[model samples]
Target chain A: MNCRVLLAQIEPTLGNLSANLEMHLAAIADARARGVQMVLFPELSLSGYFLRDQVAEAALPAGHAILSQLCERSRDVSIGAGFVERGEDGRLYNSYGFFEDGRLLEVHRKVHLVTYGMFDDARDFAPGDRFRCVQSRHGRFGVLICEDMWHVSAAYLHFISNVDALLVPSASPGRGVTQTEEPGLHSVRTWNRMQEALALLFQSWIVYVNRVGSEDGMIFSGGSRVVDPFGRVAAELALLDPGVVETTLSADATRRARVMTPLRRDEKPWLVQRELTRILGQLEE
Target chain B: MNRLDIQCELVEQLLVRFLRSEAGKFGFLRAVVGVSGGVDSAVTAALCARAYGPDNVLGVRLPYKTSSPASEADALAVVQQLGIRTRRIEISAMADGYLAPNEVADRIRRGNVMARARMIVLYDLSAEWRALVIGTSNKTEILLGYSTQFGDAACALNPLGDLYKHQIFQLARHLGLPASVIEKTPTADLFEGQTDEGELGFTYAQADALFERMIDQRCGEEQLVAEGFEREFVRRIAARVALNQYKRLPPVIAKLSERTVNHDFRYLRSWGH
Candidate 1:
């Protein structure tokens, strides 16, 4: 039961909704051409990242005409990307949208609103309070945004669920690799190490896609990658361009790995409930 | 929505235009930047590279004896990942030879000396490479006067002058910079264990958000608190942004003429020609 996925590191122009959508469409078409069943893109791929107050006004319904066209265009591929979704209550959520078979499958709003380091997710958009797995012909998948993955308290719960793979749509900033003269080179290596460690610890396939190019003064390094259940990097795309790297997930391998390491047995569902309660309480306040 | 889109598109379009226009006037195709393995410099370098080209982007890693190897590695990593040429110059001897003092005094002066030394190296490279020196100071740091005025702050062009710390992060992610560099806490690396967040007494997230609400939205204290913000945090941030406003503007000068340098009417250097 091997499933192929594509990590599309597409360059997005901030706030150019039409252009960004076109880029995603091209990437989705390419993913289908490459026989990728699922393709992941960065957070806010539709409207771009850090859009200020404009995020509120830019919010669109999942059933919008343009989105419908995108779903129709990407009918063959399971496309996951970030966008500003307008919820029923009219509150905008930083959402991960799933499109498959010419239909909108699901929309998972980011729960942890990152209020730090240039992110005002809490200020403009409301946090998502639900976590549910999307059942697909390929496998059960859990989707999260950039900060949602880093929120270990929430990620641990998502990992403990019956999901076969984890997909992250991110718009992460670039830092200096070390402390030196290589302005273009990354001096830091902790984040990459963390991704590998997380994949190994969770024993689930991971797909991470990021945006490239500068907006305002921020730089996003597009080191989009796919990690196997064995925690090995299956494919890695370059930084600063629109790139696509496709690879398959062996359903047999994932099942075998989960069985051999059945660490979920030790995971306490009660603890997750308690943690979610606390997090929810804080958000409500 | 259209206005916002137009503004965003204009920011990039005009930025490219301005950088090219400036370069055309100077006859330099590339730029040299000193990335401290921090977000600001990393973003600045990315912009210069995008505005020019990776081949035209030269990064200089100037490290003092006390500087961490991680800083040097991070700098080199960015250069390699971004596909830019680089030069690593150790400034220990330069600092030691220029400043002759007791150990304590030597240490105190070393930080400033190191900064000046790094600028010297950058200027030298800018000349040799026939490139412009790109500045990395953001609006927040510049507003707070948190940067060394003439050292790391000296540059031919600063693409990030209008952005705050948080905005820089947003743009950084959009640029697809190196991930390792994107996640670390920013620091001056002037001394060991000196983090920008810790010294600033506020996280960039909090500071930048507060700036937006207060300055951009023109919200009052009551509205800010009603929005679920902490009272003390708002007070501190309000004070910080207000006090730092002066740093974000040009140095004041006496209006000696009807057309003063920066006050009445202004023109580019081309006006003099």
Candidate 2:
């Protein structure tokens, strides 16, 4: 399957849901006119990142009217957007809603919440307990939030689950100086390297979208990119600028890359499981 | 351009845009800066001139009676180079009125009085000129709490608060500042013959390197020492940074209600505007 995808790099206003939803709608309409079949937005794009104690107020149910409208309008273009999801248990989650054919297809909550410098996601969100690839009209793909793909296990699981593409939404801050003599973006360079490595390792397309603009002193470097199965950057947006990057992805390329590399092939899941059990048995003894 | 040059250009552009946007948000298109014939003030004056045209920036030189004549000449050079308006006010009487009456002999107390006197003049000029007072303190000085509270630290908006001292020199050179100004020893000019490094007991280059490792790189003291920094110097710098935490923050308010100023009731500087 060959499909055109768009990474929407947007600057979201903190704690402004209607304004952000309008931005998303405008981006979707613009992407649709450009013949994009799939549109991916950054993590927490609906409510903006760094909400602190305001996360609860920004949380929306999966069946919110704005999300429903997005799903209803996604008949021709499938849309994947991040929002603060108010779980049924009254907890909040950083979730991505995948919509297609006038229906909400999959809701993937971010499993790994960052709790380091300038981040307090773990304090405000309940981590999702599971990870699974969802089948879409285009192909089977997996969705991961920022920091989730940093773990090798997450990438390995996604590859073993046979995902054609991995969509990652991030709100990474810009830091450090660039090495090159040119005016290159450092955070963007680091992110591109990581995404390319993951794409090459998994032999699957990787779409990474990040938010832009400064929010209360933190500058989000919006260098959204699309990496092909062969680890080549198909398309990239500029840093610290709100824009969209459209690129065509070929599922056949993933198939060919997997065959050429064969890193995913000749796998022994049962043997690894047996060895894990024997190690556990020995530890028990 | 090299990486440092590129970074300098990027930062200059960003700071210019930021200053303009921030000033516009506050319904002001004019900026007032206190130029002390130092690189930090020179860079701030240049940025302000670029942000709000040279015609809109006013450089005020508040000097004391004992201030060096070279300081005044250097400040005048910046005014002529940038083609911005300037005013010179002698504040020796204003500072001495408080100091001389008490027969103050303490150097720090006299310095603090002079610093506050300069700020008083700047704020008055800001009101008269209808311009926001731009800050000149760099990140190294801010981190070290080398600034006098409510004096050199007071500003409507600070463009150089994030740039380290060494970076300020680079930016000044990039902005085509006069060599005399950039090469001069950085001093608060609080007293004659008082240099910043002499007071701090360390050069800005050394402090900047240690700051890069400890603050930016998040290296511990042991790691910094192992990385070739003197342990005593590292410990002293760390202690200074820790002890000066109060200087970097706003006055701690007792939370007596559900909301208090700078607490739950906090808002952006341009919240209403």
Candidate 3:
């Protein structure tokens, strides 16, 4: 099915949740005007990235009063965004929350904890250990956090399941684009290519939203995209701009792509039935 | 050209010239950055190697008890591929026997120990080897007071200081860095698994673009708002960079005398009689 997806590549400020919420509202309104059915936003769109020790305190429960406020503001369209989630175990996570038809639907916590340079989530936020699908009124949707997309196992499981669309909220940082006159020797465009490749490899329609702003010293170039099943970018929001990119995904277009690719057939059998076993292993040790 | 594109081109061009000029001065003679197996250090290492030759460069991997095995492996990998000399120093005893950990705040004290320890190793190696200490700090980190004053921030010369985090990735690829090194999330490796972005609360691309438009281009917060940016983000970033300007400068002191070191009578050539 072709559904119009709005990718809101916003530049949210660190630690200012209120203003970030307002920007979401405005972007939602703008998406509604563009007749978009669903909107995707960058990870931690409300609180921003690089929260340091503050993430533990700044995070709210998935269904907290603040999330309810965001749900109300995004009443007109299905909005998916990343936020800090305080789970039942009292552990905080990098989570993506979904709101549609004026209610909360699902929240997906990031599974992979990126502990390399310049990232400190392993210190503050606990890594998630689960993956599942949310049955939205629009369609069966799969939600994953930024680093979760990097793990091919997660993508395999999500695609093999009933999810028709995958939504990813990211704060992927990279260098700015290179100029022709400049030697261009200092350019690294692999991060952009990585996202695109992941979308295609999954063979699921992707709505990747990224934040644009400088936090601490990391720069998140906002090159949000809406990719088709074939991995082609249907629409894109330019990097480093506080703007929205919208594209209509009709049910017909989705059907056409699915029929042409039939990726689900190849992907279904590969779904491992080892999830329970893994959880059991974790519990045992 | 679109004004934005033009500005991007201009900034990119300036970065190239700066890299070239820096390399011309330090490449063959001496160029080095401490490779902590982090993205920033890795990028700096690659740039230094590219500016000069790999044979002329050096990689120092200083590990403590808490340092990950992956860091040593990765650091060695970069050195081997780049064909640079490698030095592995275990500073656990030095830290444990020399410093009093109980009296210091956990994070700051750990940072101090790590920075000073790493600096001592790098400079000592630099002195014995006749190489310069290449700095790995990027502009966004420097602006936010996110780095140690004389620790990781101190360098004989730095080619990556003016560039932001996002730009380092670009340069990394252009310099043909190993995919593993280029793709890894940036981290200081101070802890078991510390990443630069997660602690900072924002990504490098956004920060670099924002810095470029606001600080480098001198665009006002109002302009960013009109451009559809979140006002709070603009204000907060601008404010943080402004507040942290001290981290980017030499130490400041009140001037009561006529011939203060930096402010007045600052003639380095005339100092020698």
Candidate 4:
């Protein structure tokens, strides 16, 4: 189950589908040359983030020609990337696609659309309805968009669903200063802390990829990284610079972490389900 | 260096890189900045010099008839230290061409005319020199709406828009700006003996400290008062910030369709690239 993954920290051209697709193809080729099994891109990698009405024009169907070309190009390496998807219901969704072996494996619509300061995703996109872990040739992994991993429940659902690794694609803007007086301390540190907690608690590997470069005055910090089950940073890219970070993950580490921690062994899904049902019933009454 | 100094250095590097990338993105290898001998413009000129190289940066000094001679000397001092190319343009005739016949006596009205006149000279020179016009407005002035619209506020890009006035002084000192420019009383210098603090009725240091507490720290009025800020001062500053909110944003348009310009029809600057 050991595999090498490359995190592509790219500066996407907003609403330029062809240009973004070309960047993705180049990164995929680079990953393949490095013998990487999988490459992960940041959120909305195809159309860039912070697109208001341009999201409609940038929306692609699951079988769109560009996606087909990406899937075709993914024959040598698996590609995990995000894009705006136009559903059959005519609603647009912030979506992630997993492509492998010249085929589209899975598409996960982002569940939580951020609507806070500087974000208007809720106004632009329809929220995803469900969450599920997808199986890959390397291992079983779960996908989470930027704000999804912020909530403890999202990671808990993935952990209970038995995912070996959690992949998070984000477009978080860099803010605040680091303890060492570096920029992007606030947003980058928060992301790292959340990923580490989830990895250590779930005894699973975590891969977090964020975009870089400024778009319309908003700077996206590109501190893409991978955390092992021991909450250790395996590999990381530079902050605010577009680059690639490739790291090899050991499957045995997860097994050893689970054995040592034993946090997941004493789980009780039935009790949790019963409690949730009771709480919902009480709230309804 | 202390924490602020360390942060200032990091920001300086970031801004230098940002200016270079932004200028190159817009197909310009050079920059044009209007240096007023004030801290804001001096720091901006220094940054442009660092970003585009002193040879590529054009520091323009546009002085009206009543502008202080000392202001021009300080601006020249900056140009000399940075070793950048400079142009001295007298704006008095241009501003008076329209203002004289109308007999405009209002100080505010005349000040705006001079500001707009300076912008006109900078923009025309920008076209001739093939350089982007970098802005000199600081966060304190922008927040207080102390700038005249479409005048000194106009720019192709602004590196100093995010830094407050006091922070601008810190950066100016760090960039080796002339002590005279950094230590002088802040002024738009629109008229003889005119100062920014005299016009605004509040010192920039006071406004900056209050802004850091109220806006950045999210402190309430009561909290601010508890922290030793005068109640009346906090109230007045809060009112000014609220009233001038429109100046900080793009012009508003009524939404009539599914997608409107700037409101819904948004795209990044890299779209054309």
Candidate 5:
């Protein structure tokens, strides 16, 4: 199926849940008015990133009124928004909720908690253990919350599952000033290359939405863009600015890319899995 | 290691945004800067002019008795170029008031006193004007602890902390600053004939090169030596960085309770703002 989608690149007020909720509601209204079928928000759209102790306060339970409010609004446009989820086991998780048809659909928890260099995600939230595909009215999709995209296996698992697109919610900090090259942040360039590679190899669309604004000294760089299955940027927003952008997903383009390359069709997962077991000494054990 | 060079046009946009956003978070739309006629302060003032129009930025020039006259004239040039409001307050009386009674004899003691007196004046005006103080200390000064604690280092926000000294000159030229500021040697203007390099016994370029290798590349002694840095010079620079570390952070609070201010009860200054 082919449909239009909107990326809401917003600057979240630190630790303010109700204010961020209002932001979500306003963006949803705007996207719905534009006839966009899906809306994606950046990681921790409800709770600002760099939440030292604020993670606990920002955690929402499954039956939370806020999530319910979003669910009701998603009847027309499917929504993907990031929040700290309070688990049934009482553990907190960095999770993205995909809602449609006036109900909460699949929720993808961030499996990799970044633990190096200005990141202590593991200290705040528990890790997610599995990668699951989300069935949407617009298209089949996968969710990767920021660091999940850094790991190849996370995107590959969804590729194996045959998703049409991967929605990545990122709150990455802006860093590294470009000197000899064009005027831009180095981190953003690195992110662009990774998205292109993942899109081309997996033969899937990459919808990357990053947030803007600063939390203390850390500035979240906003260069949200959608890459087509052929590894080309279809649309993008400006860097370090809060803005919304739109792009279209088409079945025809995906079909053309895959039909020409046939990389996925030629893939052998069972053989690879067996080899992985051998490499990991599982067969010997 | 990353290149020390910066895209000046890009940095100008980012610093402008940083000044506005960080200041706005605290309900401030006006900025106050202590313009010292140096490239660092001049570039900072230029960014401030762009962030909160010239009408909202107040450039205060605090001059001591021993300060170079050219310093004052060059500072005026910067203020005139940006069209920002300017104020000149002679700080000789304020500094001598304490120095006379305390008999502060050492040059280091007198310099520290003068630096801190300016800080007191800036913070007081920040309250009167209802504006935040924007700092001008760059990465080189901050990394080497070459600033006074709670003195020249005190500010509500610092957009230039991440930039190196070379980048400051790069930005100054990009801002179209007066040649007097961009080409002159940098000094704190605390005493007569005291330049930063002369006092530190080394050049800023040397320090920048050493740090780019030693800190950014995570190079050890052997690696640094292999990279052409003198082993003795590396040790001396590293010692300076380690010794001056206190000036770079907030006062360390002892943990007496389960949740302390900078310990378990950690949160950013702009947490709720």
Candidate 6:
């Protein structure tokens, strides 16, 4: 099966949902014209990143008119957008809401709330407790927001769930200039290696959609890409500029990589679970 | 491939985009850069010319009475190079108005007063020109507290704050600024013969090398000295960085109430933009 996906690498105005929502609508219209089956935006697409105290002000309920508009647009193209979700528990979560068929389907709260360096996600929003794969009409997609991809186990969980594609949306700040090599950020280079390694390891397509432009002197590196199961870049957007990349992702690539390696078929989750239980039991002593 | 050396073309790309995006956030499409014939100001003006078209940037030359004549010529050269609009406002009267009064005699005090007076002129002109004041102070002077606060340090947005003096020179060359400005010894030019290194008692080249390893790499004091840095040099420089911490930040607010401004209540300058 082939899925036509458009990665909307946008430059969102910080803490302005209305402007960002309008931007989303505009991109959605363009995606619809392009006949994209799935439109994936970067992390915090609706609500911009670095929303310190404004996180509460920007957090939207599921029924908000802004989100409702996105859901309505989903009738033509499935949309996955990041926002500050006001949970039913009255707590806020950094969420990626997947809208399909004119309704809300999944709200993947970012499980890994980065709090170090230039981030303070854990302080402003509640941490998500779990990662659940979304079986979309186009493909089996798993969402990892920014720093979630830093931890090995987050992608491993999606791998166990047998996801066809791991949709990683990011607002990664570009830093660390290279000296001897190319004229690009070290962070962007590292992200490339990470996606390739994960795609090869999991035998899953890695759709890394990152944002562009700057906020409070922090420039988000926009180098969105789709890595095939064979760890080759299928498609990539330009760096440091707002852009959109539309390409077809082949499911056969994943099937081919998995069949050639048979790592998934030979997996033993039960033995790993038993070993984890034993290690925990021993640690309690 | 030195650590202090940077990819000049890459740096220019980032800084130019940064100026455009950061200024656009607040609905500003114009910038006011004070060209002191120094490399920092020249590089800054070049970036603004690129970000907001040359017509949008107004390069103002705020020369005092005693400021070098070569300085004004250099500033004019930069304006011609960038093809931006220019204004020559002799600030000697404004500076002397305050200087001659109260019988100010100290050279450092006189220099500081001149710097602050130039700031006043630049800011007032910024309002009239409908532009943001572009800062010329680079990271080297900023970290060393070699600048007068609210003087040349005042800016609505700074693209040069993170770059060291060496990096600034690199960018100056890449931007193709006037060779006179690029190769001239770095100076605030507050007084007639005052050089930046003369006042700081250390060359920028030595300081930038130490700063990269000390601050960027976070080498401990022992490690700094172990890496061939003079022990005394490390202590004095580290102390200056510690002491000048206040100069780098906004005034501290007392947290008397919950969610006080800057203390607890936090919002970026681009809060809604």
Compute the lDDT of residue A98 as modeled in candidate 4.
Answer: 91
Q: Fraction of reference contacts reproduced per prediction? A: 0.00, 0.08, 0.00, 0.31, 0.61, 0.75
The digit string of per-residue lDDT tens for model 2 on A69-168 reads: 8898799999999899998898899999889999989999989899987787888899998788878888888898988988867877888898999999
> Per-prediction DockQ, in order?
0.04, 0.29, 0.02, 0.44, 0.70, 0.73
Report the C-alpha lDDT of model 3 over A2-35, residue by residue, as the tens digit: 5678788887766677777788888877888887
lDDT of every model, 2 decimals: 0.74, 0.86, 0.72, 0.87, 0.91, 0.91
- Candidate No. with top TM-score: 5
In TM-score terms, candidate 6 sits at 0.97
List the pairs of residues colliding in candidate 5. none
Residue-wise C-alpha lDDT for candidate 6, range A199-284, written one tens digit per residue: 98888999999998888899888999999999999999988899999888898888899989988788887887899899999999
Off by over 4 Å in 4: A177-184, B1-6, B252-260, B267-271
Model 6 residue runs over 4 Å out of place are: A278-285
Candidate 6 chain A TM-score vs. reference chain A: 0.97
Identify the superior model by TM-score, candidate 2 or candidate 3.
Answer: 2
Candidate 5 residue-wise lDDT, B219-250, digit = tens: 89899999899999999999999999888877
Which residue pairs of candidate 6 clash?
none
In order of the candidates, what TM-score does chain B achieve?
Answer: 0.83, 0.96, 0.84, 0.96, 0.97, 0.98
Q: Give model 5's DockQ, 2 decimals.
A: 0.70
Better of 2 and 5 by lDDT: 5
Q: What is the two-chain DockQ of model 2?
A: 0.29
Q: Model 6 chain B — which ten-residue stretch has the worst lDDT?
A: B1-10
Find the 10 residues in a row with the least total lDDT in model 2 chain A.
A176-185
Query: Pairing residues by index, what is the TM-score of model 2?
Result: 0.88
